[model samples]
Target: MPRVVFLLVPRVHLLDVAGPAQVFSTADDLGHPYTLTYVAEEPEVATVQGLVLRTETAWPSLAPDDLIVVPGWRGPTRPASAGTLRRLRDHHASGGTVAGVCAGADALGRAGLLDGRRCTTHHTVQDELARLHPRAEVVKDALYVEDDRIVTSAGVAGGIDAALHLVAARHGPRAAGEAARAMLVHMHRDGTAEQVSPLLRWRSHVDETVHRLQDLIETRFAERLPLRLLAEATGCSERTVTRLFSRATGLTPLAYQTALRLERAGHLLERGATAETAARAVGFEDARALRRLRARPGRTMHSKEASWTQAHP
Candidate 1:
């Protein structure tokens, strides 16, 4: 049985910690043999949504092959201390798997473990991470990514998906399926699946302009989206499009357009659409351009055969 350690920080999100815990702990019902524990920088941590939990171990006493799961941190903009970074780096160097869910990727990035590795975080912070870590291949279209020994998830619910993926990787597909079935969730969304694939769900952004522009961009993904034209379509100035787009989506107009194109291309690919067909459908001139866009490491295009196989096999 693999030992799993959930690493917590001050003001961590409860769901980020609880979602995976509930799934792993379900094994208790089956009388399976696995050890799961929560550890913090200190002995106790408070969740952002007003829950407090106590830890059984501190960071310095971890063992190898013990999966260290990092929950989302309180804020993305805060700096991680050198001591914390050293511990995380050393833990991974000693052959342990470090997994981060949602903003937890922020903590891994701070530990310098994500440098030059493919990784992801909540979509709202993709551009910020890109600006901060140019050496890292920061993916915007993935729910989770596993590169070398590091794993990362996109946002809230993504934590669950990533956790399930870890279980699958450690045990097998059936184990992951059982875990998800036990929890009544989907198993094995390709690691490459977009963190923000459901564009419609982006309405929850704090800014109305941001939400409106996101809707407009997604609504017209197939159309040629000139900045001036998009501004005109939204009844806002081009400057407003440039500014609000970044604030709400953490991406500029061009980046947003690219994201939509990639998403549509993925949808087409999953339906077994040919590269040529998928490319044309999503406004890419040809399959070559679509390939260029999707050729980034740590992402894959699932064929229609693969999609149906996973669904029905």
Candidate 2:
């Protein structure tokens, strides 16, 4: 069994912290043994949602062989303290897999481990990260990216996918699938899937607000969703809604909604809706309008073809 320790700091994103813990915890149910532990700078930490997480171990006692995981810190504007950076560097030097999720990637970037390495963070933080760390190749097109042992995921729920990839790499695809089954979430996605694109963010988090917005958009995608309308509907200020949505889910409300439409449109096409009907069903005024908004970089043919094969067989 591989010993996996999740490291969190004060105000860590809850989903990012919890998602992988569940993935590794359920591994034993699938008969793929792996021990999961929560470690922190201190013996306890507070989550962004006001939950207190009691750490099972402290940083200094972490073993070199243990997989060290870092969930995203709460704020990007605040720099990681030098002491935290030092410990992270030490963990990397000790030859363990050091993984960072969302803003945690910023910590790795600040520690100089990401220099010349391909990495990613929450898409909204891209500009700040590029400005801070020029040497790092900050990728924007992956759910999670792994460069050797240093792995980083794009924002919140992407941490789950990235963690499962590591689980798959270390154990096997079956183990990863079993982990996802435990969560009732999809299995590991191909690395080529859009990472930071608007399409990806709509599917990013399992939070209440995120899911509320997701359901709203899925049900009302054909309707134009301006920022003000979303804010009004959610009872938040437009700016607050946008920022929180971006921070929690890595996308602006409108973009996330559009992505939802595209995804539904995809399903409609897969169900044999003509392009025009698919567009209409998903709220597009015209099929050509759907084409302009389909930023996902491929035809809907792959899904349709798979559906066709299933039916033919």
| Over 4 Å off, model 1 | 27-32, 57-61, 76-80, 197-313
Global Cα lDDT for candidate 1 = 0.73
* Candidate-wise lDDT, in order: 0.73, 0.72
Candidate 1 C-alpha lDDT tens digits along 98-209: 8888878877888888899999988888887778777789988688999998998886788888887877777676777777788877444667776555465345578876
The model with the greatest TM-score is 1
Give lDDT tens digits, candidate 2, residues 174-282. 7887788778884466554565444443465666666667667666767766668777878878887767777776656665555666666765664467988988776
Per-structure clash totals for the candidates: 1, 1
Over all chains combined, what TM-score does candidate 2 have? 0.63
